[model samples]
Target: MFRLAAVVAAVTVMATAVVAQTDVVAERKSVMRESGKYFYGALPRMLRGEAPYDQATVDAAFTAFADSAKKIPGLYPESSKNAPRTSDYSASPKIWENKADFEAKVAAYGKSIEAARPKATSLDGLKEAHALVRAGCDSCHDSYRVRH
Candidate 1:
């Protein structure tokens, strides 16, 4: 009975560690999806003139984007940089290998969001803001993400 209890405890501890590791991925994925909602969804619609430039959606999307940017540095811990991704895309090991560069990129993302938020007031402004925001995302992905 003691042996069995020890085995169960061991399994529980292992499972808990696994869950904690994946939790970071899950949290980042949630934030990414929220950011994508505008980049892939609402913004595209507006760009194509399928929908009007809805300031409300723009506000919500970029706000979420900025908020998520703030969370990026925390999300990409050393352990998480190369953990088996919950999805097809995973963060590259470069993040850990070049920690300073990765962190600088994350800071740039936050700055991009900050520079873009006020531009949400007008369509042309939003278009520019969207471009800047996407540039930051793309730049980071090129350097530190494996999207396959």
Candidate 2:
């Protein structure tokens, strides 16, 4: 009776752990998707001269970009072999397959946006900043993420 009880308890614990891990992966993927939407949607508006490039707007967008970049590393850690299950996650296994290159690209994107933050003042300046930031995102997406 004691051995049977222990086995059941262990199985339950393992089941719970698997569910928890699945939830974590789902949550991370959600974050990535939301961030991508904001980058792709809001950025073009600012770049095309449709919207004014005030400090407040530029600051807000850049903050979002920076925050999103910071989260990328944490979302796909080394231990998980499976790709995160979420909509449009074209983040190829190659991202983790060549871990060093992935990390370097992510880091470079962060640095480019950080450098652009101060230079963005007027519309032209903001356009330049947008281009720099978008270039980073474009490079990463072209290499790792698949387009829908």
Candidate 3:
């Protein structure tokens, strides 16, 4: 029957959308986690001298962080504001309510990344850049995301 076919098609479409949305959440988390591995993991180890201070690694990490920054705004589509399957930060409703402000925060985050990457060529440089990156993340988290 046409009605049965229509129902099946509708269900398939909705299921596809849900899968896509879940993938978006996974991707967004992956991007952030990639940066975190650099920021919180590698950078600290280098700072403490627990790991060798490799300028190349520092530069690469910051560059990667900046690359992830470019992908930030795109990752946060309206549909991504809710993903029941993901343990990602429950992004605040403020992102949807005042999208302009949300976008402005993202711009600021990018600016910080730009400032941080170049400064990451040496240990002192990397430390300074790390501070800026931390400040930038704190600012955005304070406004746009809910901590759990």
The best candidate in terms of TM-score? 3
RMSD of 3: 1.4
Off by over 4 Å in 3: none
Query: Of models 1 and 3, which has the larger TM-score?
Result: 3
Regions of candidate 2 where Cα sits further than 4 Å from its true position: none
Tens digits of per-residue lDDT for model 2, 1-148: 9999999999999888777667667766776656566566665676776665557766777777888788888876654456445565545767778888888998999999998888788777777887788788888878877655
Lowest-sum lDDT 10-residue window in model 3 = 80-89
> How many angstroms is residue 114 displaced in model 1 relative to the true structure, after the best TM-score fit?
0.8
Give per-residue lDDT, candidate 3, residue 33: 85
What tens-digit string does per-residue lDDT give for candidate 1 at 98-143?
Answer: 9999888888988999998898788899888989899889989899
Per-candidate TM vs. native? Answer: 0.90, 0.78, 0.92
**C-alpha lDDT of candidate 1 relative to the true structure:** 0.86
In candidate 2, how many Å is residue 6 off?
4.3
Arrange candidates, best lDDT first: 1, 3, 2
TM-score computed on alpha carbons, candidate 1: 0.90
